[model samples]
Target: MRLIKLDATASTNTFLKELAKSGYLDDFTVVWAKNQTRGRGQMDGNWCTEPGKNLTFSVLKKMEGFQLNKHFELNMAVSLAVFRTLDLLKIPRITVKWPNDIMSGSHKICGILIENSIVGISLKSVIIGIGLNVNQSYFPGNPKASSLYNKTGILYDLEELLHSLMQNLEITLSMLQSGQEKVIHREYHSILFRKGVASTFKSGDGSTFNGIILGVGNEGKLRIRLEDDSLAEYDIKEITLLY
Candidate 1:
């Protein structure tokens, strides 16, 4: 549980990955940045957060018995950690927007990006980056982005929030080692945003359609029941849920 606090960094995920490559980092080593110059979300999306107003950090998890194909389980575990931590904070309407984004009602409050190091079909290690909105009252361009402060009208201590997140993350990540992947699957899907509800989606080909989010597939793909009543699976890049 080595923790490094940085005043500013390009990306904690990048920093931790480099440290891990040096072969000196222990499992659960964390790098936290006060100001992330180039923080990234899933699919290289820019995560814009005011300096010192949010939680931005990455964790290094050394894998022991995990395979390469079980990556989505990591997503589930991490998402549930943030989701449950927010729950402990009494944030209302907590739900995980698939692949891995934490949502409070209709607004996104957190984003997770996971990078894995693989060697011959085995996961050597995993780098998890998390950006959580804490005390930011406003978002300049992202209308659907909100923070714990905005949602609760109360300012929170960033260190306390980070502590809670780390504790929950440690417990959830252990589920992977304990063979509780099925428990993660069941709980993750239960509160999934828009599960079983008719929703609009845009395909990669620029076609708009309607569908219902059935659940997530074994490989972490979104399972949707299309308008034709056909069940289709899609990874993050192939589809976008239009609310």
Candidate 2:
């Protein structure tokens, strides 16, 4: 893995994208920033943290002829990779909120945003952007947001964490390529937050409803069993997990 350390950037994913467009890019190349000015989470949500107190990086995953149907699998793979990295740290009550938010109990600790380049049903490459709270002590405006130090009270070496996470990421992505989809699927569902439990959700129309999270659909939609016993699938933007 080629590592590019940056003092700061608007966003690591955007920086890496420009690099790829300018020249040939290697797979698993990483761009890490000490400060990310405009970090974005899932659905354009803003992510901000203390400078040099978090992990703001993007990785390039290049592949040829990757099937379009396998897109959701890639998402599953990335989510599990983050979970594995967090697991080794012994964080308490770790769970993955659907689509891709890594939470420690009720407080969020990390977020993943993946960008893919595709052509005619074949994936070309992807930029997996991760923002993890490592040593930050406080979230000024967002009480629900937290850091590893807050959760564990142990300040971590950012370089060491990045190395371990990259290794796990590489191994997990390779496993997906090696036909280990079923295994990955099981692991991901096992750690899903609120899975198999009654939860409240808000739709795009701002109306709230109750359902049980069965699992994610093959298309990456959240599968919910409604009160009427009818199953419904919803895209990420179509539904929001309120609980």
Candidate 3:
């Protein structure tokens, strides 16, 4: 694994993708930026991090034997890797929000963005971008954002945390490569946020409803048991969980 550090970039994910096109990047290659001018998140959301105070990096993972249909499994693996890295630090109330948001209690501490390259049904590669709040103590626009320093009152070593994340990521990805799908599935749902708790959700049509998260399906859709006792699956854009 090769690691590159950048003083600043528009987006680490974007930079890593271009590096991969140069035929110089290998599986597990990492690109970390001290500052990202145009950080990104899932969907069209923007990930804002104080320069030099957060972990913003992208990893290039070369897919060899994985099937394209099991891409959600990759999400589960990466999410679990981050969870394990934080768990070693003994972060309390750690939970994985649906589709890979890392939260400490009610506040988000990390976000993951995965971009995959595919040809037909064959898997090619994936660029996994991670944004982790480490030393930042304030969020100007997002009230739900929090950092490790805010939660623990202790500043963490950014390099140390990145090393731990990469180690845990390797173990998790190995599980997926070895076809341990059932184990990955069970562990992911076990730490899922609000798996059985009742919550309110908003649909794309601006309608709100009460539901309980049953877990996620293999295709990465959220499964909810609605008030009418009917179960339904929703895509990422179709619904939003209102905390």
Local accuracy of candidate 2 as per-residue lDDT tens digits, 48-142? 88999999999999867889888888888988998999999999989999988899999989999989888889889999999999999979989
Count of clashes, each model: 0, 0, 0
Tens digits of per-residue lDDT for model 1, 131-156: 99999997988999999998899899
What's the CA RMSD for each of the models? 1.0, 0.9, 0.9
lDDT tens digits by residue: candidate 3, 1-243: 689999999999999988888885678999999999999889888888999999999999988657888999999999999999999898888999998999999999999999987877867889999999999999998999999899889899999899999999999999999889889999999999988999999999999999999999989899999999999999888998997
Q: Pick out the ten consecutive residues of candidate 1 with the lowest summed lDDT.
A: 39-48
Off by over 4 Å in 2: none
What is the RMSD, in Å, between candidate 1 and the native fold over all Cα?
1.0
Question: Candidate order by lDDT, highest to lowest?
Answer: 3, 2, 1
Clashing pairs in 2: none
**Candidate 1 residue-wise lDDT at 129:** 94
Candidate 1: misplaced stretches above 4 Å?
A: none
Candidate 2 TM-score versus the reference: 0.98
Superior candidate under lDDT, 1 versus 3? 3
Scored against the true structure, residue 126 in model 1 reaches a CA lDDT of 89
